[model samples]
Target: MLMRTGVALAGFYFVAQGDWTRLLACFLAARAAVTRLTRPDEEKPHRLAEEVGREP
Candidate 1:
């Protein structure tokens, strides 16, 4: 999430500088970062078994 925000800010800086190519690249990078951050974590198939074996 923080990384995404940083990328967005960088993109804004590029826009302010009139660097269109860099701005586009930054936008794409930010979009991908946000997408990855928002994605759900994959479930571990053996989680229950592992938990059951962890008795101290």
Candidate 2:
């Protein structure tokens, strides 16, 4: 949620400052980074439950 909020804030800031090229580049970079970072770890709801010491 925090990561998403930061991305949203960055987008609005870029738009307000009229930096179209920078906005596009930043968005692409973020997309690539998120894809790479999350690719190794597939989410499973059951795993999350266990992590928090709960049963699924």
- After superposing candidate 2 on the true structure, give the runs of residues whose Cα lies further than 4 Å from its correct spot: 1-7, 11-16, 41-56
Error of 1 at 42 (Å): 2.9
- The lDDT per prediction is 0.71, 0.72
Q: RMSD in angstroms, all models?
A: 8.6, 10.0
Model 1 alpha-carbon drift over 4 Å, by segment: 1-11, 14-16, 43-56
lDDT of 1: 0.71
Candidate 1 accuracy as TM-score: 0.46
In candidate 1 the C-alpha lDDT for residue 55 amounts to: 27
Residues 1-56, model 2: lDDT tens digits: 99999989777566657677777777688788887767744453467677899866
Error of 1 at 37 (Å): 1.0
